[model samples]
Target: MKKANLTKIILSISACVLIGFLSSFATRSSVDTWFLTLKKPFFNPPSWLFAPIWTILYILMGYSFSIIWNNKGQSRKSKEIIKNAMMLFGIQLALNAIWSILFFGLCNPFLALIEILLLWLMIFETIKAFKKVDVYASKLLIPYLVWVSFATILNGSIWFLNS
Candidate 1:
């Protein structure tokens, strides 16, 4: 790859990873105090599992974004299509970060549950938009989608059990 393209990929991956670490601030602060006391569902995985899983997910998310970003548009219409897809990608990424704040920072499972649903929808929309740019990029997000789907269930279950 060209140096410029390599730089873009690295920057994209770094940005995504940074966002993930920023989001983790909430979880890190609350995990020992607030989160430890929560009434998690029986299916909830061990605490140590989240960090590595999220790391992998964020890496995949960045790679997926880069694939779409690197797609060369042949026309104005195509460029517009790419632009819209990137917008969706940004929105979903922001939503992903907000979920950590809502659930861990604010310590509100109910509110988190609501926000997670929105996050889930945004992810689905992002996948659809990315599909228009690159099918493989869209495919890359399936694990993220599946993980978030499972998280939504877990969050809802936690809300139900605790409330």
Candidate 2:
């Protein structure tokens, strides 16, 4: 891809990130209350870690998507893979945000755990699909998958301990 094209993709990804963040704004107060009162796992990192970790992961995700977007796959198989990948990507992102809403906005750790588990599965399937198109893109998702798996455990732990 040309420099200009790369710039456009990155900017669009950033906008997506911003929009994702903003969409959860109404729940911020609840997040503050619920997050602070939570009985976190012993392995849980400080709250400050989330922003940076997610920012980097989002950048990697954007880069991965760009690879798919840049592909000129006139082949039927390639087209199907891209279409499925994009759809799964969107679903996983929605799940990610919905987990936050379930946990913080509704103050329901149990439901959040369920949502996150599904999110993890979606992400794994997405990576599997992306691999057929670009190996590097699949590799880029490893950290995200690992982090969410860890998070799933952490979410369960919190719910168990708090209950």
Q: With candidate 1 superimposed using the best TM-score fit, by how many Å does residue 104's alpha carbon deviate from the native?
A: 0.7
Q: For each candidate, what TM-score against the reference?
A: 0.95, 0.89
* TM-score, prediction 2: 0.89
**What stretches of model 2 exceed 4 Å from their correct place?**
1-4, 23-27
Model 1 agreement with the true structure over 1-163: per-residue lDDT tens digits:
2112676677778889999999999888898999889888889999889989999998889888888788778999989998999999999999999999999999999999999999999999999998888888898899999999999999999999999
Q: Tens digits of per-residue lDDT for model 2 on 70-125?
A: 66668998898888887887788778778777877788889989999999999999
Top TM-score prediction, candidate number: 1
The top-ranked prediction according to lDDT is: 1
